[model samples]
Target: MTDSLTLRRPDDWHLHLRDGDMLRAVLPETARHFARAIIMPNLVPPVVTGADALAYQARILAALPDGMMFEPLMTLYLTEDTDPDDMRAAHASGLIKAVKLYPAGATTNSASGVRDFARVQPVLDAMAEIGLPLCLHGEVTDHDVDIFDREAVFIDKILDPLRRATPGLKVTMEHITTKDAVDYARAQDDSLGATITTHHLVINRNHILVGGIKPHYYCLPVAKREEHRLALVEAATSGEARFFLGTDSAPHSDDLKENACGCAGCFTATNTMSILAEVFEAAGALDKLEAFASLNGPAHYGLPVNQDTITLRRTPASYPEKIITGVGEVTVFDPGFPLNWSVLPSSV
Candidate 1:
């Protein structure tokens, strides 16, 4: 194995940098590690149009610390009422990079999501025409489907059909957490890709309930069984161009997380690179780190690879337990133990 690995500065193809004070607090963590991030649109009302996306992007820019070079690639939240003409204009204007699909009640702040696939065909057709990627939160919200089986069911019932319907559309299966997702993405041509979250690679469903309910481990597309985790590790380390890093490092306030109805997301941005490096190292595929972390994402998105480089070393590191947001402190997903790998900025 190489003693060190260097990669083009990675882009977080999927991320959630919430608005207002929360934005100010968490943007720096993501900015410190990623060159660019595809910001999620599931805010209070959601960013549904080009105008809202541009305004949101401005707020993100204003929140960034000076001299901290990080680009926030914005997206519009797809809803039944989303106007196809507006979406086409947004992509053409270069104000938006993607359109996120969150089936109603699929995850946090997604209550306004689309209820039926047929209702949003116009917007999807427009995206296909314009060459914009559709980022999906792939879970069927049917109450009868076992929570663990939601992803696989969605793959059969929604994603596959959607892809067949819009054959020309580019798609990124975001934070994919199942073996089916891995297989589906890999079977596709380069036009389709998948983003694997750091947490999903390292933790399984047991991590959430093993020792009482660990809210920090709770995330949408919630962690799956060990077999699925192994599948993700294999897909991520396979050096396949379809797999890339998209740390869905969503942060929720501790109160919101530890209460009766805990929120659905893990605050992993603070230690994502470290966790990723550890997983890749253990699999004896450290050599393939750069492609998963850097190259594949930009290539799929049709953007040039970043010129700068970042290094991951076999060094010990510790992350804070929580971040102080204006509403309240947010719990981070560190296991409260030192990590075996650490990411250090490098001048390339």
Candidate 2:
């Protein structure tokens, strides 16, 4: 058996690092393995302008633990009032990498998201012209739509129409959890890409509802049926350029998660690489790991891959059940199985 594997350092195409105390608590976990990450912009009030992105970027850098390095690729939250000129400036200045669209009320802190698709056409048009990508929370908010069908329905009713209308726009369907999403992304041109979350690839709907409710397994774009989970694994392990890693490692205090209406997220930033190594190795696709986790994201974003490297060993490793942060203790995502691969000390 292959005992150890080394690859170029990976980049998370989609991540959530909340600001202030929460940011300080979680930043090091991600920075330890990933060289960079596309930072999500869903904080309270949201980051809607170039200035907000710059300020947030500075804060992320300041909060980084000494000797640890990480680059924050900022994104702007798309709202009805989002200024096209500001987006252009942000993209041109290299502060913002993409614009995120969270159909109003779609996910956490998304009350400020876009309600009318027509209202943002100008911004979409400008983004298309400038070659900026759009990172989407690919689910609908219609009250009548079954929670499980929201993703598939969004593709047919919204994403398809939007792409038809905007000829050159680049779109990254974030944390896609359905076979329909997988097929849609596979059929699209190079302008399109999809990020498969670490947790989505590891858990399925049954993991959440099987033995009483497992709140830690719950996340937005909630894990689908086993069939869908299989599809995601196939795509992610296939070495397909359109599919890559995006550990939407959102952290919520244990108090918030165990309460009546818990927040949607999975805290996997701490062990994503190790878990991924196990998944890929299980699929007999260990050769494709680097492409999925390290190469594809940068190619899609028009950036260079990291020069650093990390190694994964076949030896067993143990991780904490929960991490104590200044805000509160946050539970780590449990894979529900023994992890045989563990990330070794950094090579760079």
Candidate 3:
């Protein structure tokens, strides 16, 4: 059964490989595992234009280790004033694969995000016409909304209307954490899909605060209750095309994560596929793993599925206490245990 679980190479529908030193340090981790990744654009200044995205893509390519085959699919961070002309030009140039919408103050380094959906109507309309996917951070920034309720609230107040306003727009809800999000993605047309992260599938909100404040477990669209975690697990293992892998493996220097107000994100890109294999195996759905990890994402994007294959073995492995960076080492969300599954070399 372990030998039979191997799959065609998978693409990470979502990933955060920070620029410069961090980018160099982490690119190998994700590139080692995923054939491609939908690179997030929430950099310090944010990649708000076609030019910025193109520049960022170059940096990613430069950072990759020699002999590693990894494609970094670029995305523009949409701002209220983002020019529709620029979006169309980017799509035509094939430099940009999608546009990411981060509502202002929605998550880490998202201060430059859009202040209102209405302000980006023209850009959204152009994307719909051009067939470009709008990858969303999927959380409302209202201060009054409960932290855990943000995903659900955004679905009701923002996503639904955005879908209506821009009919035929391709949307990928990134890092979905709740049952409401699961049901919403499933109900939408085939153009709409969602990315599920490794952390949300294995840990509940309680794991974040259980014995103590485990800052490493913290991430935006914070992990919800146990029931929500189970729902996410079910969705990922259900062989449903709407649900696919998106590590959203954001990395923050330890100083920032442990400070007065730690930023929101997790650095799980290193062990992402191993963690995912473990989750699906535990769910008794190993047969569906390949579809969730490999097929679903590219299918929704109208891209060809990867022909290369990768293997997953139920082998033991350990995670580091922290990954060193120039600024400071970043603590990883080590399950404080060994992983039950690991990826191995494979030939399709």
Candidate 4:
């Protein structure tokens, strides 16, 4: 059995660090393990302009504890009113790394998301021309579409058509939950990539609904059937460059999560690396874990891989049951199995 492994530090291609007290509390968990992350812009007001992204980036840096360094690769939220020229300046100035599309009402704080795809064609054209990636929530909000089928439907109805109409608009199908998405991403060329969350690799619809309503297991692009879950695991462990880790580690207070009409997200930053190690080891593809978690995302985003490395040693992992923020307590994700690998302390 492998006892220890070392690889370049990983980066989370998708993450949500809500503003204020919540941000301060959860920022450290991810910074400890990742060298950087593609910060989500779905704040209450949403970061839609270059200035908004700059301010949000500042807040993220301020919240980051001293003595620890992390780069927040900020992104702009795509609204129908989004200004293409603003996006160009932001990317050119290195204030933003990508743009996010939420498909209005698709998930939390997505009210500002686009409802008219046509209105954003200008922005899409700008992105394609500049080589800036567009990260999509990858779900449609049509009430007629069954919740479970939303992702597949979005691919056929929205993504395919959009990509066809606007070629070269680099897209990352964020938090993909279906095999249809996997096949679609594979059929495409290098311009397209997909992100698989750590929780999605481990849980399925059964984990959320079987015994009882497990809110902590709940998340947007919600877990799908057992077959879908198995497919996700395979793609993530297959050493495919287009497939990478984007934990989508959204955090909600315990009170908000455990209530009627609870929010959609899972707080996984505290234990994602450990959970990923367990999943890859079980798949007998431990060797490929580095590519999925560390190498693949940077390659897709046109960024250099981190120079530092984190070593994971075989051992039981320990993490908090709840992270107490000023707003409320946020529960850590439970993988339903004891993790046997952990990030060892970096040697100075």
Q: Write down the TM-score for model 1.
A: 0.97
Kindly provide the TM-score of model 4 when superposed on the true structure, using C-alpha atoms: 0.99
Looking at model 2, residue 29 earns an lDDT score of 90
Error of 4 at 39 (Å): 0.5
**What is the alpha-carbon RMSD of candidate 3 to the true structure?**
1.3
Per-residue CA lDDT of model 3 for 28-104, tens digit only, reads 88888789999999888889888999999999999888989999999999998898998889889999899999999
lDDT (tens digit, per residue) of candidate 4 on 1-348: 999999889899999999999999999999999989999999988899999999999899999999887999999999999888989999999889999999999999999998999999999999999999999999999999999999999999999999999998899999999989999999999999999999999999999998889999989888999899999999999999999999999999999999998999999999999999999999999999999999999999999988888999998889999999999999999999998898974632
The 10 consecutive residues of candidate 4 with the worst lDDT sum are 339-348
Prediction RMSDs, each to the true structure: 1.2, 0.8, 1.3, 0.9
TM-score for each predicted model, relative to the true structure: 0.97, 0.99, 0.97, 0.99
- Over 4 Å off, model 4: none
Per-residue CA lDDT of model 1 for 26-97, tens digit only, reads 999998989999999999989998999999999999999998999999899999999898888888898899
**Where is model 3 more than 4 Å wrong at Cα?**
1-4
lDDT (CA) per prediction:
0.90, 0.94, 0.88, 0.94
RMSD over all Cα atoms, model 4: 0.9
lDDT of 3 at 274: 78
Worst 10 residues of 1 by lDDT: 334-343
